[model samples]
Target chain A: MSNTADPVSYLDYQGRHKGILGWILSTDHKRIGILYMISMLSFFGVGVILGLLMRIELLMPGMTIVTPRVYNSLFTLHGMIMIFLFIIPGLPAVFGNFFLPLQIGAEDVAFPRLNLASWWIYMLGAAVALTSLFVGGGAPDTGWTFYVPYSVRSGTNVTLAVTGAFILGFSSILTGINFITTIHRLRAPGMSFTRMPLFVWTLYSTAWIQILATPVLAITLLLVIAERTLGLGLFDPAKGGDPILYQHLFWIYSHPAVYIMILPGMGVVSEIIPTFARKDIFGYKAIAISSLLIAFVGYLVWGHHMFTSGISDTARWIFSLLTFLVAIPSGIKIFNWVATLYKGSIDLRPPFLFTLTFIFLFSIGGLTGLVTGALATDVHVHDTYFVVGHFHYVMFGGTGMAFLAALLYWWPKMFGIMYNEKWIWRSWAFIFVGFNMLYFPMLIQGWMGHPRRYYDYVPRFHATHIVATVGSWVLVTGLLIFAITLFRSFKSRVPAPSNPWGGRTLEWTTTSPPPLLNFTQIPTVTRGPYEPAPTPTGGETS
Target chain B: MKEQQSLSYGSYVLVWLALVVLTSVTVTIAGMHLGALSIATAIFIALIKGSLVVYYFMNLKNEDVMFRVMLLVALVTLTVIMVFTFFDISFR
Candidate 1:
């Protein structure tokens, strides 16, 4: 169905309420997913501008633009905005809310009202964080980590930010609980766990992490609030509280929070690769189990982040060892994706191109993670640009590319219109190239002991800093083109085929921009998600 | 709901009695201050009480394997984290 198709889709489901109210008040998971997308992208735009400002300020190294104080607030806000607002909730809330039920052949999530409540809670949290910028002191300057002493002592609005994050954690937990219940109770009669799509599997694992791990963050942030207001001695050294305990609690959630950010992206890649490759996924069980394994091992590795904070040497060793082990499941997933591409009909579609880029970029991110995971190297690179580059590669590159891939992969299904292929490829090239150019030099400079979060740098680091700044310009342009081209497709509004990518999942069985209840009749999925397809001998044969 | 079973008031009383006995034993052990053994003993007793609540009071015994496994996984995760944190503090 087109946007103006005969059938009444979710876009018009809330006929009683018109415009924004209809969207905000509707309980349709699909509509809720769209609401999340719009709100998150708006926040993303703010984060992008903040990132660009930081890059501009860092261009010449010696107070080129903003002062050190402003730079501190900028980075802090950027981190808080990107991590809490965009990345962590990015895939699952937007795509997961939209597709999880459809993929499992359900009418909607088990709790549609609860699902809507999550979106509202998320917006409320995000608004609270952004509001911190205006009142109760300027935006938090303790950086997003909000390490104690300074966070407790700072005159800025650390309390509001931390409380915002606390509320957001609840939102995350609610979504997690809803997804868990939905997956367990709402799967169609014949759609067994193994028969579910990899996307659903990743969401399932991520939901567990969200439910269990997010509370630690909620409590930790509440402790920060307590420390800020009630003079709680929980994390303050002056009051006999160890600062490292803050680190321990923060990473306890934040580390698995990493998986919360990346796992869904991995899921998107899992879905995209098979569709583009025209082959059943290789080692499906391995990929599915690895998602769980990663979530399991993910909890133990939070200690690695505290190694340099003067945690015990034995703890360091244990954390380091566990960190290496966590990489195994991650490696298993990467290997399976690569193996799936082998001896197959690989289509170099925009979505596939983005998926391939995710593999390359995420590999760099994942490997560099090892460097940080190890004690010796991490000591040298702990607060350096190396850590910055590594995280961006993983977080931005990995999740960012997957987000784009998911956007492209599901765009037709989402809007019932096909975007221009030429612009899609062009945008992909710039993003891939510009992304590397932007972040890669940070690694080199960081390796050279160039510290991060510093407004002023020595003359020696200026060269690399300039290159990264220039790369930021290119990256921004590419991102602009990506957004514009996709948005422009609405003008022509060409109707999309139900199974545009020849996807085997239940989502593909429904109409593009599916109808009010998703399916006229719920599908009883007899076949596995990725059934085998003929190996096409056309362009880009793998 | 299909697995729901009728429980006599006497069984509830027995579970409550067992919990009380375990708590007093734990308290008496704590009063003795048997070095590291005191903490270990207290924790062990707490685990027994917790299991009894889960199995009987919570009716996990009659629940599906899936529910049991979910509970086990959560408990195991919590145990691992707590033990590891204590390991870091104690050993180093």
Candidate 2:
């Protein structure tokens, strides 16, 4: 039975198996990817609600909605949901799973069953994590970092939450393994590492970090559980264990986790810029190489997160220097993206708008990171709203915008339906304006010495918090419209073209909502991933 | 793809004997109380044993270059993280 001869779309494959079970049990990478997309978006919705609630609670000098205890739990849940559930697994699990095999001209990933198992594990882990909200000890208030001594002693279900994170780590590792194997063994005849798309390269680098770095997080969280249960002196001062060591172990996995979250977002941007600009990506090799460099150097800079935690002066100096080095590769990527746009036929589409917004927003995020990376500036704004603002800019503004851009970019391909252009632009406006209003003030308040996670704040910080809270409403409205627009497209009058954006990759050559076996036959590539668009017959340059 | 070698029983017995000899040597060295040198010797001995198992039993030695490099890269990454982490702890 030749797979290429099979005439069914992955969406409709095994129509005999009806309803949700088709999705839950199917091993098709595309179906699993859709499953992840639906689950991730649901969790993203939860995270956004929690975020808005936290912002509302901080709107005035005192609590506006819930008590301080509830507010504490709110922020913890928000961070836990956003980081572990949404951002870390966001791009790779959703887009990476769907596109990697397609882009590489393969039928499926190396391990389809393992891929499906990872998604189940992810849902199980998420369910376990949410259970903490109602079970023994209320939702963990130790915050997402689960800083120890407090974590070990807290009556909240820290063990369950930490266990959930550990389970999720395993999911990440398996996905990483699947991706690495698929990329290594399954590229089309002429495709080489350098010839692969930047998105694929970024996924490759991210998978490495996932496999290598996530184990440390698993062990660290397990130690947290052990400390809480077995009375291990691992990180408890009462038991003579140092709390700083816990920070070390946590950040060792986490600082790389930051890269795990952002690198794929960068890859998405790289794909968008070239297609919209109608040009081959500038500095393709440099961008691709820098991904690996960023992943490698990212591991060394985990020490920066612990500079003020009573570490030795020598370690501080070394870590501080390493932190700055990690920025160079990121800078190279940004420059190449901008350079790719220079003197090109720039299309001002919605995805292009988000890409431009990502460049602007991510730059702010990256630059502000330097301020915090410095030893002196970080000491002042370590736990302040500045760090909070900086983090949102990078995570939400950087990766979030990129995520939306990817959603917009790939929407047509995934659904075989066209979105309303006017609504797309409208959502972009609300999101762009709302995002800045929401996060920009935190930078100011943070610089003005406003601490984060405070149940209440003084009058000086109240005005900015109010602005931010108002911005949260706008951002949510924008996200609401964005979702509605995409959902409406499911019943769209016009079917999407196979290559809506004229993407110069294997995916664009196939059918929209591609068939069960990705291509009619395995593709044989002859050109770079991004080749120049053919000149019009009438001699138009663009 | 690799050609799976059918190892004779004699080779398996010889490998087993070599492992036993190494274990005995490690025990003798540990009994000598060589201080810091003992830790290094033990690690070195264990690496040899582990490599033997990986190459012979696990068949990584016969796998493609890509798999070997992947394994090497993982080992190297873990080593870098461990060594640097020790740098912080030891200096502090």
Report residue A492 deviation for candidate 1 (angstroms). Answer: 1.4
lDDT of 1 at B41: 88
Residue pair clashes in candidate 1: none
* Candidate 2 Cα deviation (angstroms), residue A539: 15
My TM-score estimates for the predictions, one after another, are: 0.95, 0.94
Alpha-carbon error at A61 in model 2, in Å? 1.7
Name the best candidate (by lDDT): 1
The DockQ scores of all candidates, in the order shown, are 0.56, 0.59
lDDT of 1 by residue, B1-92 (tens): 35599579999999999999999999888899798788778889999999999899989888888888888888888788777776566765
Interface C-alpha RMSD after superposing true interface residues, each candidate, one decimal: 1.2, 1.1
Error of 1 at A213 (Å): 0.7
Q: Write the per-residue lDDT of candidate 1 for residues A282-306, one digit (tens) a residue.
A: 9999999999999999989888887
Model 2, TM vs. native: 0.94
Q: Locate the minimum summed-lDDT window of 10 residues in model 1 chain A.
A: A533-542
- How big is the positional error of residue A483 in model 2, measured in Å on the Cα after superposition? 1.1
